[model samples]
Target chain A: MNWLAVKLPVLVTLGGIFAVLLIASLTVHLLQRRSPGKSYGELRSRVRSWWVMVGVFSLAMVLNRNISLVFFAFMSFLALKEYFSLIPTRRADRRVLFWAYLAIPLQYYWVAQAWYGMFIIFIPVYAFLFLPMRMVTIGETRDFLKAAGTIHWGLMTLVFSLSHLAFLLVLPGAEDKAAGGPGLVLFLVLLTESNDVAQYVWGKSLGRRKIIPKVSPNKTWAGFLGGVATTTALAVGLAPWLTPMDLEHAAMAGLLIGISGFVGDVVVSALKRDLGVKDSGALIPGHGGVLDRIDSLTYTAPLFFHFIRYLYF
Target chain B: MVRLLRFLFFAVLVRLVVLVVLGLNVRRREWLPKAGPALIAANHNSHLDTLVLMSLLPLEMLPRLRPVAAMDYFLGNRLLAWFALHIIGIIPLSRRPQRGSDPLAGCAEALERGDILLLFPEGSRGEPERLARFKTGIAHLTERFPQVPVTPVFLHGLGKALPKGEGLLVPFFCDVFVGEALHWEGDRAGFMAGLERATARLADEGRFPSWD
Candidate 1:
């Protein structure tokens, strides 16, 4: 069997996850032993959920291409569901939502078929026109602008942005093909997730000036810069092994992911604030919801996918 | 055997559709009685409301939990009647009464036998987010069975998920707010008003405050 082709990266990623989990387990154990409060309880649960998330992700990647694509597609579906659940919509926009959901499989089908043109324009162009046209037929114009805008924005962020991760798996060429497309996905996920962790650690230790207290109270400039610096260094080190990028481009990708990751987090925060919700939903045990966990990726995935495509592909 | 079949179908198959397809999150489950005879009343917004409420009950309660569906609407066809009678175990209440037949008789018998009954006091599906005037049947039932507890349930987002006359089932996050069981000993008018007020409170709880 040619399973070794996929096995190496899976093993390496699993090893890295084990090391991180061990360190986190020790850290939480020690910190909570002294403090023992709500934050400690949340941290412990978050770490525990990470193990399950990592297991699901690894199994998808190891199984084959189809399973991995389906996994990410399902994630996009969930994130979109959460987004719609929280957002206000007019009674007229009901049918528009059906079309919006219909776009998920069509978009992912393009990814599966490796039809780049359709995948890129399906939501932005076709769905952009189609959703409004469909809403117009429903004959409710009271909240036309707001309703249409809300549906389009949801499709853009939840479906279009997240689909890029699945699209990454099908990028053509020898290097990515040899490395297995999952490596690129794993690379992006690892860096984005690490950036989140780094920011949290940095913010707790050194955060002073709030970046945007109105939007997200906890985010600070110190955490943002510290996370960017650390993530860039890791990206540069891991680029040769995982991605096809040179050191310079990898560093650039890291910087892009780190900054945009924060943007994604706060943007979702702004949405939640506007809607007056603490978390999107209680889907994930400690992470709040699927949207909370993948908020960073909503921005990073599309940007990084296009960046690599522009430079390397 | 039939009860077990109904339990498996609704608890497993129907619950899967409500949870996975509809993405409903039942809140304040503690408000629902774990067992016994209580009239579970909710505001009707869509056909999906009955299914969503049915999915929230404990599996063991399914055999005894009878959702009071309209005989004309759900039993319009033989196939639907069979599914409603056999699978859902509905106590089909006739909207328009025929001579010599009591619509409330069946419901009363079920409650008297210690079976939990789910009723939609709104009579039929109304517009999303707005409550229709509740019918007086609930007050009559509560008066007859004064010992039975009437729990008000407010369903949020089912109207949008599968509103009236919409064929497509759009997946949205729906919340089932099960409120405390209300008991009343007064005139039918007063009792009906109290039930309506209770449902309105649950509805307010379901809605996001204007500032929010």
Candidate 2:
């Protein structure tokens, strides 16, 4: 119980975030009410959901040291479900999705168990061998290429890539270390989410040039650069409190998270383009289903986790 | 209600994202103009067809325009079930032969209330963009409500965006050509024959891409 009280710094940090979000929401409401144009009632609703999600994640950081991996694994399951629903698979694809569903809990279990060697290769190696073998036994030929591609891509993006975050949980650190290991997870999440907010704010305000006209027309270079700058500054500022990384390393981490997050967003945009339907499901208000919210994390998790593992683990 | 709207808003956001990514140009064919209590009869080619039709309509017309959808599909979930029935004001019909009910009553009620109704005479999804044989339900509707105008809309390109069994959205611009409203005259067979001819003519124009 004393250890819980000892975590006041982390608690206050999160409280500060809530206070900022509250002020921002009030500002958006006031501006919308006073402005001449119609209020973006939908956009405001989405921002409110973002506030809840950020608060929940921040509170988890204060509640326990080990909840990060569990929290992310749950997110991975939701994201994978959204991905598979949008991308149609054959009846034969059911066998593949079954393997995928099993892989979700197993991969997370590995994280909980802290089996580094097995967790690293569970999908790329073991499940890779196991899933294809299951598919081959089914002996269906129609759209086999598509079936394989869809299942493999689903696993790679949702399970294999996301598991890296869980793998980050067990990385070796000095026994007496205060700001490392679990703290790294907080650092990554903050940078990624902040980048999203910064990009949306800048894009809506000063966006003129489309970043990628074909895939995501609303994305602007102004937004991207603004996001990168803000996230980089945040990472640099928070590194000492959250990780063993120096200023240079923290900047690099932020750079990687921001760039990779943008790339992930573009990739999902292409996927949705391939699937004519928008949003995976309507579970979250203001945000699309679980998939739309975590699309950036699909790419960022693997990259960020590995960077930390290589440098510190 | 706000929560449901929030979910719908995100759904729209996802669609907008896909539309922007794929460059989907949603143009509505206003051949019949904004006539009151009209019936929109279009070929059922793909799932995206309904959304495209709804998107192409004027925003003001959304609350007034009711799309007739299958009961099994639209009524699968509770919230969507409510939205389909009450919010979007969709008219649900049962396709199962075992069940026989006055599906047209809902349509009739809406038309009597002076709201436009969109009905797919095919009653099911098909691969080709061509019109399938018209179900007797449409004929039944016309016979009951002789005053309501039936506008035939030919939409080209949505079949490519979301083909049956394919989940990914392909970017494509489509044109919807609205034909003159056809009224129910004395002869049932002749009225259907005329309806078939109009649809076939639009299909053969070949200016509209076939669902390949």
TM-score, B chain, candidate 1? 0.92
Candidate 2, position B24, lDDT: 34
Model number with the top lDDT: 1
What DockQ was computed for model 2? 0.04
Candidate 2: the clashing residue pairs are A273-B169, A274-B168, A274-B169, A275-B167, A275-B168, A275-B169, A276-B168, A276-B169
Per-residue CA lDDT of model 2 for A33-119, tens digit only, reads: 888498678878887887878877766555554577667776776667556545655644454566667888888888778787788
- Give DockQ per model, in order: 0.37, 0.04
| Cα lDDT of model 1 by residue, B91-133, tens digit | 9999999899777999999988999888989898966667899
Worst 10 residues of 2 chain A by lDDT: A1-10
Best by TM-score: 1
- A-chain TM-score per prediction? 0.95, 0.92
How many residue pairs clash in each candidate at the backbone level?
0, 8
Q: Which stretches of model 2 miss by more than 4 angstroms? A: A1-6, A65-68, B1-212
| Per-residue alpha-carbon lDDT of candidate 2 for residues B1-212, written as tens digits (9 for 90 to 100) | 75456346435753573443223322235565485688888888777677666666666566677789999988999998986776556788777735456667778898888888888887887754556797767777888888878888776655655666777554344446667789999767877787777767665543431122
> Which number leads on DockQ?
1
